[model samples]
Target: MTTSPPEPGLHEGEFHGGDLDAARRRFPNAPAPWIDLSTGINPHAYPVPDLDTSLWGRLPQASDERALAEAACKRYGAARPDMLVAAPGTQTLIQLLPRLLPQGDVAVLSPTYSEHARAWRREGHTVREVSDLDEIGTAKALVIVNPNNPTGRVLPVERLRALAADLEARDGVLVVDEAFIDAMEGSASLVPQLPPSAIVLRSFGKMYGLPGLRLGFAVARPEIAARLRDNLGPWAVPVPALQVGAAALNDDAWLQRTRVTLEESGDRLERLLKGCGCEIVGRTPLFCLIAHDDAGTLALALGEAGLYVRQFPEHPRWLRFGLPGEEAAWGRLEKVLRPQGQ
Candidate 1:
């Protein structure tokens, strides 16, 4: 399988109020909507913790920024402090990776997040895509999305270690974007393996259901981390985001509860989709990837019935559903797309 990066025009939670507005204009008396499943986020979002008012007013400076990152390292079990860097979101770090590693050919595992390729190409670098890590060219920079975004595939850590060693031998960079690894059964995280040629990116958005809060981090070798810091510059994350991220990361009890919820929800999702004659492909306790011959039609029918699901343009046959919150939403979905013959 050959992997190319995600093309543009594809996004999680894609919808235009403009489109809805147009639909409303065409049919002003349409029924109101209830829930959205466009993005693979937990519908039972973690309660937004109340923050100190000072967090909103205070400007994030270098000292507080360092503290925030250091706290994250501890939370993730990283011993070295220099390996971590905080950013507004994982997207910022992915976008900056191309600029940071300017001189090499980049290879990305396919059916993964599109941002990786999009960022590289925008910086005038051509990216090679591969379906499996074995097919990836020995380019100076190799990027992989652990528990991959769209397909939800997770690569083994031992395989990544071997790959990293090979890349290091060629003076290459091995970037493991672990954006969704927090939800995996056993993550092949490279946090314990940070060095000059190794890097990992993590997102707090998907894990904590705080996408609007926009918190993420990158772990790399000391020198490489410094370079990323110098290039990306100061005020990397706003004070409020930093505060919330730190609080959430430290809340181990909450995280465990969230994981349990994800597992239960994912099981229900699998059964529900299968009941509708859809095939389950890849999944974690957090989200599931499913395929149908006509995802577009299914998406429209579901949306028209007041349930919004995400449809992919590049892979027209697939649809990704976020874990729904209530039995009512599930009931609505079942009513919208009942069993093949019942």
Candidate 2:
């Protein structure tokens, strides 16, 4: 894995995956050819077709944007194309949402993505981290990451809709981040039943394995989406990203096959982690969260062997393992972890 510096503007305790430089600095003696399973991104990326040279020579057209939105709406089950606001990525939208909405108390489901809390707090909103959705009482805004990152906890759609209704009655809003939901079958998304007070964020990178393309969407009432679109300006997503994303979203055949592959890969990952004496706690099709008495130690051990897994400092017993992309990567993980089970 090539090394790069930590991303600029990262808050304390907001470390992300895919920081190979940090891994290298910490484990200098580790061998080359690092197996990076730190991020829950698909190792197999969608095949982006060759783009026309005109895509580069000219500014992205309004028609191209419309096509991309239409494709995303179809893929994500949004009510209409206008309901979706294309952005550079969900991370950008996450940072902008608190600013777009009225300032008030914001409750984020805890032990999940830290950015939701950080973004709200950054926007001067009173932030509360709650473990249960029922505990979110009276907050003006509620944020949830469905099939949550690192932990992989999934909240039922029925309960989420009920909460949205309750919040809407009080003039509040519910923001759902469905970044990992793409790989899960029969998962409920808020986009199809988008209430005026509910906003849903969808990621194009994780399931498609093209995080570099930096494409994502925000599905909500047209008014809210319009505001987000305005904030993002006229040409938020690059032309190449629009072309690649539109084609990938419209490819139903590839989506179906990839879903099955991710499920099988997830099962294989779960078994490998279990075999290493890690107790499985939660999982999604792209990753597994396992518990161990000394997760930090295990993470370091794996890192020193040129295998990088994710560890949460706040949750010392937890470690997250993303699916390996290739057979060699899986074999390397198993080889390094086998001694732990003994």
Candidate 3:
């Protein structure tokens, strides 16, 4: 495997979690069967139902897309079908929104997801990284990742609603990314109480643990949704994604069970980390962000042991751990982490 020097800035997009090939080069002699706990993706993915042969043979029909959107609305509690626009992924919408809207100042919550800032900047918008919601004054657009990535900070709905109201007066927009909210309970998703000036982005892959499927939705008012649909043009989502996402969304039983299982798994992870002398700073059920004085050293150590966890260059003291998929994976992680405590 080829190896390159790690890039400096967080925006390189070259150092995201779950790049097993990169890990292999970094730890070429570590071991076989590396345990990947880097990304927040659920280890237990949804079982995709079989697809009709016609879905593969022909172009996706308008009705099939409509059915997928309808299912997403029902599943996500959107006010109307027209309010939601399906796309290949939420990442696509992130890159598209800045171009669709008029150029203006965009404020994003910092030490969070880097893509939002990168997307806005790529489209020639002035981007500010605000540490607090109150610091978003006069910005034409505000982006927040609810149950935030890496940190898992959840903003209250009332605060977001008020922010939306304030932004609406200036004809600005508030974008909430709910990619990690599916496994979280009592989350204040902007979908149900979606404001006219606010657009909420949801990822089907994160929640369903099928990132390869590449399905996501943008929940906004009718007009904005229509504009996004026009920009994406026809047949944006694949036929397999439409059918699979619909089935997964409608499976309430699996959703409930997965939530419980993830919660238990999170608690188990907390115990393991704490037992290994790591400080648990923040988390969602899907992953835990831990603090260590030398996180880079620890991450390197773990990588050498064939256990990969996420480390943020922006925050030198932090490392994030995703849940192991099975008992063997969990055992492997525990065995690797035990030496750190010693």
Candidate 4:
């Protein structure tokens, strides 16, 4: 399917992935159609069911929410469906968690998602971005993005269990953003026995290739889940999101096939990057990080060639590439990259 492109603009400070609608304005000289490889969203989206007109006419029903939650629990391997809180998206939960959860000196695993730290700070909490667990000394709360974005580093579940235990003792919560963990084979998920003080976030859109659906989940103890659900109020997730999310989650065959395809594509991307003299610094099946001294210039060149990849200004040496998602896109990327070997 030919997917619509994400809005484009300078990603200098805030997230430049989905919000920018001014791509033509920023890259005036570039071609009309832009290929966006900036976000880790799966390019091959789940086939959306032809939603009934009544879905649009009426407000969402409670039964619809329950069904979606049930599907999510089965999909996520969670025994406690009561612990699931369906929200507009994980981004909404990210911002809301800070206000609802206990306040403490928060430590986020650094060089990961910018939103985690930003959310806490906006709520008047002191947030520290730390690379080492030991560096998080005396910090009551901790946040980590598993199979971390940009750099696909994963911390083992046992270590996180220990951290959760420690935080629970201190009355602080351990927030694990497993947004990209769905496609991971033998995923190190902290579910089935999610610690009393631990809250795990799951993204429905990334693995299923339906980010536009704006569906995501937060799993925690019933108490935390209740707080999040109540605060989000009634009909937080729309009828459309609920329908598609349920359908996709139950489609195990699609999940299995997509994982295999993404892995193959990820390997192909690695080889392509290597041929262009880029060091494959980090990766998950969804994205690859290229380490080159002049990554900024390389990114600019790719952008000028009408491909939008993600670049972290703070980490100028790294550029993250999502899958091209089509044969033509692969050809275009190869064409642009072959000429400019790092």
* Sliding window of 10 residues with minimal summed lDDT for model 1: 9-18
Q: lDDT at 152 for candidate 2?
A: 83
Q: Write the per-residue lDDT of candidate 1 for residues 1-342, one digit (tens) a residue.
A: 232322232233233111334333433443566456656666666677787887777789767776777778987767677778888888899899898766668899987777787888789887888887777776888889887877888777778888888998998889999887776544467777555577899888888887888888888877888888888787878988877777778787888888888888889888888888788888866678898876666665665676655566767778787777788877787787674314
Q: What TM-score fits each model? A: 0.88, 0.95, 0.95, 0.95
Off by over 4 Å in 1: 1-31, 185-187, 339-341
How good is model 1 by TM-score? 0.88
Give all candidates' CA lDDT scores: 0.74, 0.87, 0.87, 0.86
Per-residue accuracy of model 3 over 89-137 as CA lDDT, tens digit each: 9999999999988889999997788889999999999999999877887
Q: For candidate 3, what's the RMSD? A: 2.9
Model 2, 168: alpha-carbon shift in Å?
Answer: 0.6
Please list the residue runs of candidate 2 whose C-alpha ends up more than 4 Å from where it truly belongs after superposition. 1-12
Q: Which 10-residue span in candidate 2 carries the lowest summed lDDT?
A: 3-12
Task: For each candidate in turn, give its C-alpha RMSD to the true structure in angstroms.
Answer: 4.5, 3.6, 2.9, 4.2
> What are the clashing pairs of model 3?
none
| Clash tally for model 1 | 6
Residue range 194-272, candidate 4, lDDT tens digits: 8898999999989988888898999998988999998999989999899999999999998899999999999999999
The lDDT of model 2 is 0.87
Worst 10 residues of 4 by lDDT: 1-10
> What tens-digit string does per-residue lDDT give for candidate 2 at 1-342?
332322222112667777888788888899889888888999888998998887887778899999999999999888889999999989999999999877899999988888889999999999999988779979999999998886788888888899999999999999999999988777577777777889999999999999989999999999888999999998999899998999999999999999999999988888878888899999999999899886767776788899887777667678788888989888888888889889
